[model samples]
Target: MSPYDDVEQTGMGTHGAKESGMDERATLLDFPGADELMAAGQVGEPSAQALSGALARVGTAAAAEAAGRGTGDVAATPVRRLSARRRVLVGMFTAAAVAAGAVTYANAGAGSAAPTGTGTRGETRAAGAGVFLNDMSTVAASQSATTGKYWKTHTKAGDTYLSQSMDFYVMNDGKAYKKGRRPDWQFGPKNVDWKGLDQLTTDPAKLLQLLRTPAKTNDIAPFDQATALLGDTPASPKLRAGVFKAMAGLKGVRLVGAVKDSTGRGGTALEFQEARSLGRVTVDPKTSAILEYTFTWTSGPSKGKVTHDTILSMGFTDRIG
Candidate 1:
């Protein structure tokens, strides 16, 4: 019944799609099995019974775009087929729709549908998502370069008790550290080499290919790919714009008017909700840098469970733990 129910099976938990070579066994004291990535706000779906969620997300975006182009009510856009190019673009947006557990295609007609705008605000929300992302892309492209010997990010997740947290400080060599937890070096370090980040391009098409390549996980889920890309700020302004553009293209993504992060930082957000997983990425309007990811599980015992990974700062540093 809930829109977000489709995301449960492919948990945003610690177990990744298929890690490229990351072998770090992170210790989560209270929140067991929650993937550090998910804690950071990443993941997505399944059928008529299984694939509806993923398909809906894809169809919704396509249909909404179509509705906007026509004179009719958007609700009647009739989840239809996209052209070869659009189909391919849709695949890219949804990580080839791999989040449904396997790569599946939306049937176009029966499988997809867009949310009819509830009223003026709904129309505004739908349209605002597109414009907001465009604004972010513009901001990203206009920014200056920020690089150091290491790229650092602060990740935090808390429940009613003992707030869980860690610092991911990765050196240029790709080896990383958890500054908050002693034993600075992670055990059994997985090879986190992503030449893509270093050789990041401003071209959206090329960058999409690089980002979609399975690195952290074998299955290249676009949502995770996007989140991971946000893990470290792109080395260049163009690449940052590319990241923003790539995100704008995802199928079911939508905007929430205004929100404040756990740290009480206010900003705009975009999200994908399927089954049990609710993934949100918030951005600072002024800077265009992704501030953090927030995840919520809306069903089962984990219902109402929430997690957040906030990026205090991310850039190069000379040393690794």
Candidate 2:
């Protein structure tokens, strides 16, 4: 049997405790619902475009490994677990593999394992995640204020088409456009204006309270509203800090430490689970910027499918370009 088969089957090495040829230090744990995820779908053939995007997302190490070999030739590469700072790196690589057609990730169930330098199970730690967000509030509050003619945000959203991902841009002045699609204000949440955004209260509690008002938030969940505001607007430092603080107060926001965003930038991930799906938001610990937001449908018609909205760049820009 191939090494990949071994990983998919027993998930153990010769000694029955460690992963073969990967990290010997971390113990191999059976993830919950491994059988189900595996049965859901098998990894299909990797497309050239998907492989190129994956390699580019992984950066130097994976690139160096694939330097001589063509992208398709690296199919034999062994998957690794998350370890210390490498957690995000491995996550991105594994995600790329998934996007490249590896549907069954062996490490998905390692939610109970603590993140060391060896590997991660992508589990959430409640207390740890809360503390991290509170700290981020402080970090965000210290950033210098910025302003420009328009608040611009560039995003790469879910693959609803053959291209595998959709790229779009939204401007605060009610203009939205994407490649191969006509420009419209319908790309983002409706009724959000720069003037309204500027007048938002900087107080965390009041801001959250206001968001909870169904009329102002368009009846969207306050958490979703807050994250949407954070991602699409160039809110002031205090307002940005307020968003973090408000999120910290929300229950079930767990920390999946040191995971990479869709763009492959390492950041801390905060997740909240609803009845039908799980939503995760990754933020840069240093800058407290929202890097990516992913939603995975767990128990619906869309079960096992994942969609990610990644903020490629966001700030006050002189022109909407």
Candidate 3:
């Protein structure tokens, strides 16, 4: 026989032998009908021979007793024994299947085992840095408060000036407050109630010019300096450094720098180191209005460690009354 056939035969035979022992008593009960035939001597020759063989195998008395009990012990007893062995094998197979399935499920969800250096967070940071630099370059040029007008005009009233306003693009890189807005007004004569400023003259360019020029003590600075220093320009360094120094001493602050182009036409371009975290200030050579200022800063959770970079841009007009 083939090897597989040999194994199957051996397994079945071993199983059958074990079941046979358990069913011996039950088999005895089923022999009575056959026993009566033998006793009566009325059984056919073929039936008698078959009954004799079964009796010899089971023993006659045991079989007769089992049959009298009417328990269906002959055929059913061996089947019950075989079922018990089948249940054990089924249980073993089921447990192995469950273990293999669990292993496969775990491996499927494992993803790549190696660590990825460029994750979503890193990509976001990189994009943000590029955007920041571009914005900084623009702001540095805007905040210098440079003016082109040959004759600039100024007017002052008691603690108030012409209804003018300067708009600045500010970046609060520090994220110091809950909301993006923060308190940034300083009290002085020129501190026109923000609510009261005339709508027509509130141009950032005009207001910026007034702020930079030396003003009376009661006069408020024209432009919001903190918001204007985030630009690119040659003068950006001086303005940025000056503001940093000034901030050290003040609590709440408002500052303004006015510059005019010394030469009639706008020719000179502001210059500065783009990479360093410092301040730069530049002015229009002819108008003498501050044209741009750039401030670089670093702040974070670590003691004195920087967490962010930002620039502010300011603009101005010659219409200040």
Candidate 4:
């Protein structure tokens, strides 16, 4: 008979334990309880699948018990076969998988993952929203007249390039550059209103503050929003879910990503073959206040595919106190 014949033919005998172990092993082979394996750097898609299957079996047993149809022996079979550590690992993987699926479902117009803890969920959501709004406000306030600069650079033959400097000034009375008084070589037009350096100088710590703000309500900061804004589409539902989950607990003043370098010299601005995704925030590592943050997005289309390395950098300007 086949190796599995005894397993299939028996009820609960000497072969039962062996069969159960084999079943658990097979379940693990398919899903492998990613959380535990990942801790040991062994989790991947295959492990995820196996873990999912194992969880499904456990769930089936629980459901059967709830219906009063499952015997104690039947209910305990899977549990008794798997070790406690393996069970915990499977549980974690199951949670992650469920969360990822929930995100996809929510986005496709299904239920929500917004928790229902003792006002904790609402508080978390509010905190995340507040951080995002504050960061936006800070960035907006900093984009004023005296502190902004217009810089231009060009790359022609792989290694050789040229640079040009320009000054930005905003006039409230609307009379700074008149008809003939405009600069001889205008990058776009005199009407191209731009913020000045004085405004930028008002917030030296803005970048740091924005990067450290919480981005998620229950998990990590929203690295995805920054990535999406920079024009990178996430590759999978899991990735999308992970990113949104992360954003709920970020702490920062302003976070901007996907900056394209412009060369005003030519009519065509050279789009960085790969978009640069970066974040800036203040962070307090000791108290979790997030004194400074500048995590760069290193995965996606722009990584290692660009003609030249595009260094996207952000600096914090001190607030005008």
lDDT of 2 by residue, 182-289 (tens): 222111143444555556667777765665555532435556667776775656888787777676666666666568776688776767777778888887765678
lDDT of 4 by residue, 1-321 (tens): 311222222346665687676875655434322322232221223356655654565465445443653344433454434333344344443443322221111011111222222222112211122222222232222122222122211122111111112222222233332112222221111111122211221222442243345433423233433332222211122222222223333333232211223321111011111135444433211111112223455567655332332222222222210
Candidate 1 lDDT tens digits, 1-321: 332111222233556734411212121111211221122122232346436655665567556655656654333332232223243334323332233333111112111222222223111212245445544665565456755554444445311111112233333334443435212111011222333344545676665565445554344346655665655443467666676776666556667645777778876777777666788888776566777788888898999998878876555444554
Q: Over the full model, what C-alpha lDDT does candidate 3 score relative to the true structure?
A: 0.28
In candidate 3, stretches whose alpha carbon ends up further than 4 angstroms from where it belongs are 1-278, 299-321
Give the Å error, residue 205, model 2.
Answer: 1.6
User: RMSD in angstroms, all models?
Assistant: 20.8, 16.3, 40.0, 21.9
lDDT of 2 at 242: 77
Q: Give the total clashing residue pairs for model 1.
A: 25
Winner by TM-score: 2
Quote the lDDT for 19 in model 2: 42
Which parts of model 2 are misplaced by more than 4 Å? Answer: 1-127, 156-192, 211-219
Give the higher-lDDT candidate: 1 or 3.
1
Model 4 regions more than 4 Å off: 1-12, 16-20, 28-89, 92-321
How are the candidates ranked when ordered by lDDT, highest leading?
2, 1, 4, 3
Q: Model 1, 52: alpha-carbon shift in Å? A: 50
